[model samples]
Target: MFDTPQSTRSGATAPPPASHPTLPADRPGPHSKRLGYIAVIATFGGLLFGYDTGVINGALEPMRDDLGLTATMEGFVVSVLIFGAAIGALIGGRMADSQGRRRNILMLATIFMVGTLGCVLAPTWETLGVFRFILGLAVGGASATVPVYLAEMAPVERRGSIVTRNEVMIVSGQFAAFVINAIIFNIWGEHDSVWRYMLLVALAPAIGLFVGMLRMPESPRWLSSQGRDDEALEVLRQVRSPERAEAELAEVHALALEEKESQTGGWSDLATPWIRRLIIVGIGIGVFSQLSGINVIMYYGTQLLENAGFSSNGAILANTANGLFSVLGVTVGILMMNKFNRRAMIITGYTLTTTFHLLVGIFALAMPDNSLKPYVIMGLVIGFVFSMQALIGPLTWLLLSEIFPLKIRSFAMGVSVFTLWIANSIVAFGFPPTVSALGISSTFFVFAALGVLAIIFMWRMAPETRGRTLEQFEDDFRIQHS
Candidate 1:
């Protein structure tokens, strides 16, 4: 079995406590304000992630008018970014592990800016696809890196809420995109090329991430992993209460020392039984989160609205409600993360979302083609979005950040999120055509079926990751699988 701290052993047989990461009593105190600052800056990675992906939802129609896009081309445009993200998640995870999280994020920020500029200026649909892929790399990198940075910087107890701050930003970014797209489309609906303006908004956050990260501290856990214990503790003191910093450092130092002897973080480590199980869990979380058919809505909500009978302008405006409620969902989600059990929350979310998907299908199938159909589905879609953002969405990222040991955390996360992107790619590429050929009712039924599989997999395979240190959780996995 892998090594574990003494205090965590009592948790082995019982389902993990509360599903929230709270520090031991003595370790809680007056943390530095820098913790809040760091969360804001680093999570811009998420904001950009949201804005870039969500922008395309409203832009696709105008781009089709200008570029003469076939349905296949539209699917390709959306899925290419996701495919690039799969590659990025893989590469970025390795980079975060080897290059240091702060350094990796700075590099990603630069890529985000360059990629955004490239997409904005692309002369053709083909050119736009290439730049979108580049931007995907940055999004994937940020997804794998930022949460790790936040989790490592935070006090043990605060890890749940702090790490999840990125999820809130991601949805908020999407919300901003929807709002911006609506406003711009309303003001400039006559222009075929106005999609460029919609995409341009992403540049602001990409720049913010680059500038803010320059002044931020490197992750203390990452420093210690590199045999820089003194530097790790120094970084820790910036965000933590002095006494808590010292205490956390001792724990971090012990874990780092042990990791150096035992781990060589790479794909080969998958041979280890516990690590393999953990990787499977991570990948499942990523895959199922998307299988909830959430991104399909994020990517195609305006189209779906149009399909249901709204005009171009009306659909774009209606889609903003989805964005607004997602932001609201994440707000409530962050607050609830402090108290809930992770497994229970996810399971409940899955049940409700699956039911909602089924309802959308039924409503689309049974409700006569009329004005009321669109609003009813929109209301249900809003509920589905809320359950996803509030219940399963943030925790997906939080559990990923919390469950893995420090050495392999990013690598495992990269692999998992890679699958997430790939799954999303399938949905993106498949959704438009599916909806076109089969109509909305059958398309949603397919998603509902997929949701059932995700619920089963999560119920049986996913772990509860609350109320523990990184070292403690790793040890439990090791022991459980041993």
Candidate 2:
């Protein structure tokens, strides 16, 4: 929905103001370097979020065996966290908006720690699901809040790269979890406590995030919006070049004034035509992103492969391949984000994914059920996952970060991403039944049909937001559908 004036200037090309005497004349010094480290440390919340959500891919079978779980209990164990995450996403936004980003994250870190503990020490399926749900609350909130915090703290030029770096970290965290899970599962395949080890590994990163985020500053934009200019400036100086800091502060102050005057925070903002349209676009992105069935692959790929005919070991190994491809695809997507138009990338991604879905369905139907079927189906499934990670995955998070106004960034993102988790839960819970009834080919064909619809929706409604500042993007969003 953006209508901002396009500029080809690189991030480094923006000129400093003449009057801001405190601004750096050349480049940042050692202090700025340290600030970058702090940002990474603070964003480790994302890493923990990624690991906790993805670890189940390897651990599920062991968990099922240990708990004597049926299909419904297994689904509950996996998808329960998603249900909690949906709630967290809804409430975490308000917390971030009112309590401040730093505080909310710290609280999330505590939740993360507690959730991990609950999972590790769980005596039964019932206990494990409860803890996982708590874990999901923290993960969901962190997902909604971390990107906004990163975006606000980053320099305008580096904003996309910095915020997207968290996405990279997220995928990397998932990769790390998969690798760790493989190693642990391989070494302790016969051990009764194997799943416990897999689940407990998440605690290290949670501890790291909790401790690291405590020393980080609150978001400067959030502070400025609250009329705490001095604190905001102090935060800005810590993260930005001295010369650039003042100008950025002025810009933030101007925007905060506008926000305050308009009283455009919270659900009421959605009443305005432009705001309503923006929220719709945000929710659309969330729904389409999930409807791509990425979570179906992430949360249930191993089961899907087993159904295709692989032994348990083979399925676990093949699932690892899926994780690796996901990491690789996200790497490619991040590299291309700066080079490609957002809308074009999304359209191309949906098209490719839909085509793969159809091909996989056809292959599943035509090939007689045999040992070769698992490997063949594995190849197609991994291919679809790669397409999603390379295209839709990064784009979905990127667009969510790009669209909303500064005033409602956290709240709006929470609402949209909360819906994302709900969608994920629906797929997770329904996938087994869907597969049993419709068969794999038919199930994927349904996804393929949805993919085509997503493509059409993107072409008509999604906006190109690449290479624009947050302030400029906001202006563009206000009038995009007018």
Best by TM-score: 1
Q: What C-alpha lDDT do the candidate models reach, one value each?
A: 0.84, 0.82
Candidate 2: tens digits of C-alpha lDDT, residues 1-482:
22123322221221222222322332557646756786687668878877988899888888988889897898789888899989998889889999899999999999999999999999999999999999999999998988888878866555555677777777778778888999998799898779999989989888998888878899898999899999999988887777677887897788889889787478888778887888888888988888988888777777898888899788878888888898888888877766666777888899989988998899888999877888888888888888888888888887888788888888899999999888888887778899999999999999999999998888877876675667766875675555
- For all candidates, what are the clash counts? 3, 3
Q: Lowest lDDT 10-mer window, candidate 2?
A: 11-20
lDDT of 1 by residue, 286-323 (tens): 99898788998898888898888777777877788889
Identify the candidate with maximal lDDT: 1
- How high is the lDDT of residue 145 in model 1? 88
What is every candidate's alpha-carbon RMSD to the true fold? 4.0, 4.1
State how far residue 277 of model 1 sits from its true place (Å). 0.5
Candidate 2 collision pairs:
23-242, 23-243, 24-243
